[model samples]
Target: MIRDGERVTLGDTAVTAHATPGHTMGSMSWSWRACQAMTCKAIVFAASLNPVSSDGYRYTAAASRPIVAGFRHSYRVMQSLPCDLLITAHADQDGATDRFRTAPGACRALAASSRTKLAARLRADGPAR
Candidate 1:
């Protein structure tokens, strides 16, 4: 598994992992600099922010508290980055394909929005019961 904030090299590309544990523990997001000839851009592969389930699922369990906190932290980290491209597991989550062509700050905006939504959900649910 890739450790959070660890940078790994793939051929000429350097990718940094960011642990984002809300949807699942050990979930990761990645950031890298993509270069093409003289043009270069910072890109981020955002992790899934939506919750999912397989069989039995519980978000209010005591075991999930820390995982939820990790997601919040990861959202903050993502908001702080100035990436030119943002790709998430779902295109609609950040409108990666739709907005990538029109906006440079879409990733940051999406991060902030996701964080806000996550905060509200946590507040309303009050953690695992």
Candidate 2:
């Protein structure tokens, strides 16, 4: 939960998850109920999103395959979620944006950062000898 404070439940109308990857091993995107965007303001509603990967978890070969498959499916699921709120763990990207920013935009920023890091890693480990 990459929220400002501790996780709290309000009348079962808060906190949700969405898978967002391409940033880190376990990248996620979240939405809060307090935000005015949500039409149902009566109740505090929020979403918690994370990245799903082929190797989301470490386990036996047989189990690993299933886990990886599940992660891939989870990633797909996040794609359909409403991503209009920019909320990220890394303050530099989405978190850096103004108080009001689109979730998809934030996600894009996260993806860019992830690419940058991946490129750097590849460069650092040039042609393993």
Worst 10 residues of 2 by lDDT: 41-50
For every model in order, what is the number of clashing pairs? Answer: 1, 13
Which runs in model 2 stand beyond 4 Å of their true positions?
Answer: 1-9, 19-29, 32-81, 94-100
Query: If scored against the real structure, what TM-score would every candidate get?
Result: 0.76, 0.41
In terms of TM-score, how similar is model 2 to the real structure?
Answer: 0.41
Model 1 poorest ten-residue lDDT run:
94-103
Error in Å for residue 98 of model 1: 5.3
Q: Report the lDDT tens digits of candidate 1 across residue range 1-129.
A: 678889999998999998877777778888899889999988888787765445454555687678668777777877777688877777566435542422677566766777777666656555567
Give each model's whole-structure lDDT.
0.72, 0.41
Tens digit per residue, CA lDDT, model 2, 18-128: 444332324444544544454532111122222223533322245344433444443454444445564444344323543444544444444444444444543544543
